[model samples]
Target: KIKRMKNLPMAALDSETVTVVKRKVKTKKKKVKTERKKRKSKENTSLKGKSEPKDKKIQVLQKNENNSENVESMKIGNGHDIEEKVNEGKRSKEFESGHDFEVELPNKKQKSSFRKGNDVEKSGEVSTGTVLKKKKKKKNKNAEQNSELENIAQKKIVGIKDKMNAKIIQATLNTKYKEEKLKTALKKSWSSNGYPLKIDTCDEDSGIKLMKRLPPLYYAPIFFNFYNLIDSPSKRISMFYFIYLFQFKQTTDLKNASTPSLSALRNFLYGPFRKYLMNITGIELDNTVDMGSSLYEQTDVLLCHDDELEGRRIAYILYLVPPWDEKDGGTLDVFHTDKNGQPADIAKSFFPVWNSFAFFEVSPVSFHQVSEVLAKKKRLSINGWYHGSPVNRPPKFVELPRPVKSPCHIEQEDLYSWINHVYLDPWTQKEIKTKFQKDSQIELEQFLAEDKYEALLEAIKLKDLKWHYEGPANKRHYEVTKANKAGELVRECLKFLRSEAVFLIFSQLTGLRLHKLAPPDSEDEEEKSSEKEPSPCVSQEIRRVSHGSYTLVHDDDPVGSQYALDAMLFLGVSEKWTQALGGFTSYIARDEDEELLTVLPRSNSLSMVYRDKETLKFTKHVNTSVKDLLEEEQQFYEVNCTYYE
Candidate 1:
């Protein structure tokens, strides 16, 4: 029934469809009008004259659309362009909705119904907010970094400044203490009356003071025995006797006397209190040249020619007082030029403490004497001279009608050659025998073999080897070591030996012409040598038979003396032998005795010899044990040689 009805109502259905179509059309028209009105309202509200010109606003809108399209194109999401369009439409709707009423323009010549002030203020407020936010962020970041750095710097600065302040305080305190101590010491030294001479009494008469007199120059003369001066116990006597005569000239008329009894003067001069004189006075007066027929008597004084004047022209005296004994009275007396250039006296006293020095000038009138020794113990001191310059005149030899034959030259050349040849060819039996032979042929052969053959021959003719030592122990081992290692380690082990050897050689060579080299007194002899042992002087005399005196002979050529020639040859041979022998080795035994361990060439075997400490005698090893020697002595030679090389 429904199907038949549907077919029959075609006309009616057509009429209804038409009516519906008309209504739809009308609604669509209404919607379009509404949309247009909304768009217009939005445009009127948003496009105010203050925002921008109409054309510029349109351009900006178009630019915004293009930028949105570009942003959508860059997006990866599906339907991104559709979503962006929807968002833009929504934004446009929202903008339109926000405009409650449509803005009106008064006329073409009047401005649009929009205020520039509110729009500009709103934009400016937004920009200013953004700028302030950025500035705040940057300032926070900079402030944080700066605060951190400042904290670290402050921590370091505190420690550094504290340390600097502490150091400054310590330095100030130390300086203050040092200055105070120095001032105190200076004050004490200045106030002490330890010096021997009193400045106030310098002008007193020289005769009134026993210390000023040359005969009894020492104070408390009664305490000293006068008999010991004439009898000297030492082997070497100094040439200070001449100075003594001059010093005593004011007290006695010995120079004018027909025959000066120097022996009597010597006897008178001896006294135990002389040490006190040395302490208070600088004078070291002694009758050294008064020996009968002594060479010094014949030799003319070179520096001072005047007979009347005596005493050291310039001298230094060292007074050493022991710290434990203040009453020992060690003082130094000095002669100096006064303000008017006349001789003036000055004195300084020293306590035997370490690092004490007393210095004063020396002159002719600076005569001074030491006080008598009150203590039983001896006082130690050193005295010497300083000349204006080197003496211009040559040393004057003893005057004689003809030059006396020096007994030393002949013995020196023979002994030197023999020792040199033995040392050079220690293993050569033939050479040794030839050198030792008594015949002139053997002696001539040895002389010819020497480096200074002419000199050796002349030395043999003159006999100038009085002071030579022949024993093997007398050889200087240290000297040999030094010469061996002279290249790189110049100041090594060899240096010590060289220094000691020089000192010993000088002691032996510088004849007893100086006060320091004076002959020993009886007390000194007793102190130095044992009662059982023979005197060193007697032994020296016996040795003189083999090695004669070193006096110059008339037969010797003036060009170069035979003695000098022999010395040169001996020195050369010694040096050569030392090098060839690989230096010398010395050992100190367990018994406090010294020994020599000679190394054999090519064989590498050590030959041992025992040396007597007192006499320095060498003997073939017998009961001596090598194990007993000090380790240093045993190894020093080998180690020193290797290190030096």
Candidate 2:
């Protein structure tokens, strides 16, 4: 019964539990048998294809072995270990294909692979994350640098564009001014033909008859009295002169006519006469508003000098109307030589106050334009030039006698200086008159004996001369006649002689009207040369005569010696001439082991001599090498020789 109970215990086990155990036992037995069968099959297969399978297995094993070896041997680095492993894999592949590969991997790939290891965590190698971070940082730095460079390039481009725009604006302004000037000039030319006057009166006899019929003057001399009435201290008479003349009952009335009040004349002149003249002249006179000083009210008048004149004298009258505002448009523009020897802008303005007259030599070179009026006041002045009379009459007055003790003497001096410096020096005036005369040639002897000429030659030899004439070839040879007058002849002459050593030497040596060469101070502040301003360690007046033509007027104050040297350098004048002038010789050493002798010509009476350095003997002539002279005058050579040669 006990045996039966044990068997029952075994039989009474749960069905689920009994089935699980049986299945496990069967699965284990089957697995064991399958493994045995597989091993047996594998052995048989290997036996059938032993050589091929063995080789493949050996290759695979070798590749795995090599990969493992590379991984182990690789140093922990960023991408370096990975690169080694990848290269090992490639080599294994080439080996399996039975092909020799000499492939070159790119530098970046090599570096990346060399940084990463197989077991990135265990090797403590650089992970892809860390490598990406480094790359990103480098990229960010490069981008910043590129951005900065781009900004700089953009700024430079913008600055250039701005400059271009400014130049365009200036050009536009200049063009506008030119157009206005041309229109006014044409109108004046037409009006001067007496287009509005009766045709019969155009004849000289008729004009003279009309003038003779006018009333006789009593307050002053017949001729000078008329001027007094017009020039009355009263602004009313000055302003209403035309109206009074028209309203006068008889010729004798002018003699007893009392001058009008100044205020009344000023008002009339400002309101009606100014407008009338402007309308007739077609010159939109305006005052300069930005003038820094109150000494003068600026007025502008524009004119054009065309080639159509053909050397004939043309007469026209100008009426000045002052501005209401003292600072308004009042500049008088004059044509002068530019840096390139072309006509340049030289303008001046007169005060809008009473009794101001500006008269200048009339020619093609005499370009005058009025400034804009700022004060809205009327300027009153009569404008006329003396026209030569027919042969039967007395000599015609070319210029009005200058008023003495004039209130505007300062202005006059400035204007005179400018005129003398730029255009009509005594020499220039003589030159012009002689040249305009028939068959007139410059006589060198005419000026040689003058004390001024002698002094000038002495100054030039000492490098102290500030001004000299620059004239064209054949200027001295040609007899210029009024019949063959040309406007630009003088200017052309100056341009030709700018770099002529022979001309400069002759002028200095002969002492002929050399004072005419001085560069004039600009009457108009705005027309002042750029080189006239003070600069550090350099105080000199640099007047550009024409383009590429310049003159340095050094202040003969403290550094006269230095300025003399500088003048020699600038004019490229010969030291031989200096040596020929006796007793006032000074030695100047140059860098090229050369010496120059500075001489003053007028030391001895009327003879060329040289003072010897070693022996104090005055020789008849000195040997000053031309080369040394040229070197000493390097600036002049550069400016004149380089351009002309």
Candidate 3:
């Protein structure tokens, strides 16, 4: 049964996590004027180098071998210590079937030490302990061991066993080849759309033959592939291979391992699998293949990216998930690329199918992401890239710096009025300020006055107003209207964003000089537009949005490198708020990949976080997990504000 997010301020909906992926009809290449047609772009490599004369496939693949990824990364996992404290009294811990390579789950019965506040018990940063050394030796003995394991094979396995190869696929479904699957002259069609590509069969012969050629193909194969291959599975390898750009974690790998599964699958990948993929996609690759398994249980997610790695020709994945749905997440979510080649939004998404293979040739525009898994089942899959000759080169494109708002002007009289009306007392304020200076963040439970919060909540729910979604989802999925677009009473609440009362509250809580983001000036008001650097003082913007109606996850703030303060004002949906439904936010330590804090966007609460230059934060994705509610209570809404410091 699906776990429900119960007692949430916005009671969760029971609706299936339905994703309406907007798929456009395939557009044939159109003729264009020579001047208008942009030249075919090559790999800019973005942040990594590309296009050297030599084929670095073997070297690169060898370096990337057997990487084990922490499925939840810092998202949350099989009940880490933090999870135990957070889920205390409400949820039970679940484990990965094969092995417990993860750190110990938190003990639930401990006293709840951290809450919505600045006074958290300081926890040490996570370190993997094993030191990587540069010394090299002993390849012969390792090879001998691997050779022995390969000969002692396990019985056959296939993930999605129904469609083994073309013949079996044809026999079972009577699927006549509409076109030859692995046609020699076939060329990849992924450049136009960064959407996912799927093939039910490799066009090989039978299940027995196909099964034999593949690895163990165990259900949820992550532990078997990553942990067992390691010289020591208990000690996690401290390296990070981001699933997509959204989710990243220190991964476990077989870089120093030589296991039987790896040996058995070696010849097949280098020979048949390699040859067949090339014939079908019509993309050439040398004998090098770089691959590994990624396992994700609930709350784990892989966000968006173009997969622009060095020497990566085609990025592909073969799933070994239990029976699942898009709701189960871990889906191949493809995005639309803007003409400039940056990811735009999600165009299509496909569920993880057993024994199925999906791939796309890595390109300048090949953007895709994996949705956060919500299902109770594990999503285990092995992903790899076919490496070949490098693509052409192009100069990197640098984004122009966006100007920050000038400080908003606040009248002294109105400031005093709000101070008297809603501010925290002076003595308590001093304590918070002291804590903020030391820790860099704070949370305010019941941040707003009861009366004002009630009025703001009612105004935001005005039925006549329409809510819009920013699509092709790499951008984000919250409603289109920023909080400032709400009706009068709700807009009145945003005034707090620029109010001296909140500024003082912020100053006391974050030790940062807080200033209001100036109301945007008209273009005519600028005196010769120039990029003026943002002030060190804080500036703010408010957004009113909702995602409780369905499932979603947003980008890891694109302008992440900058320093700022982010606030979430939970509009009191009244007594329904609960943590299980997770419309919460997390602050990630930039240097350690550690999660510094998680704050629930609970009603009547204000979660304020200081974003130092080295850290990034994201609101955890959420969807309706309960049903049958009053229409007004069906969605959870947050009045979001960002203050740049």
Best by TM-score: 3
How many clashes show up in model 2? 71
Deviation (Å) of 564 in candidate 2: 6.5
Estimate, for each residue in 1-645, the C-alpha lDDT of model 2 and write its tens digit. 000000011121112121101111123678757755764566324222111222111111112322333211111111111112223222111011101112223333322121111111212345532111123323242344334443443454345434433333210111221245533632344332222212112223111111100010001011110111233322223211111001111121122222222223333333453453345343343321110001212121222231112222222222334334435545443344333323343323333333332333233334344443334344444333222221132222132221211011123332332112323245665554344232211222222223433343333334322333331110100111121132242223223223233223323333322122323333463244333532111111211121112111111212322211122112223344343221122333321212243333222122222112221211111112212344443212111111100
- Residue 38 lDDT (model 2): 62
Can you rank all candidates by lDDT, best first?
A: 3, 2, 1
Q: What is the lDDT of residue 13 in candidate 1?
A: 12
What's each prediction's clash count?
20, 71, 28
Q: Rate the local accuracy (lDDT) of all candidates.
A: 0.24, 0.26, 0.47
Residue 543, model 1: Cα distance from true site in angstroms: 4.2
Candidate 3, lDDT over the whole model:
0.47
Off by over 4 Å in 3: 1-182, 185-262, 279-284, 296-300, 321-330, 372-378, 389-404, 407-424, 482-484, 500-505, 508-510, 515-558, 573-580, 623-634
The residue-by-residue lDDT of candidate 3 on 289-405, one tens digit each, is 876667766656665656777898877676766788876777776665565556675555667876555666676566677777777777776577889999784544344433344
Comparison by TM-score, 2 against 3, better one: 3
Tens digits of per-residue lDDT, candidate 1, 457-537, equal 233323332223321111111112222323323222123222322222222222111122333335755465333332111
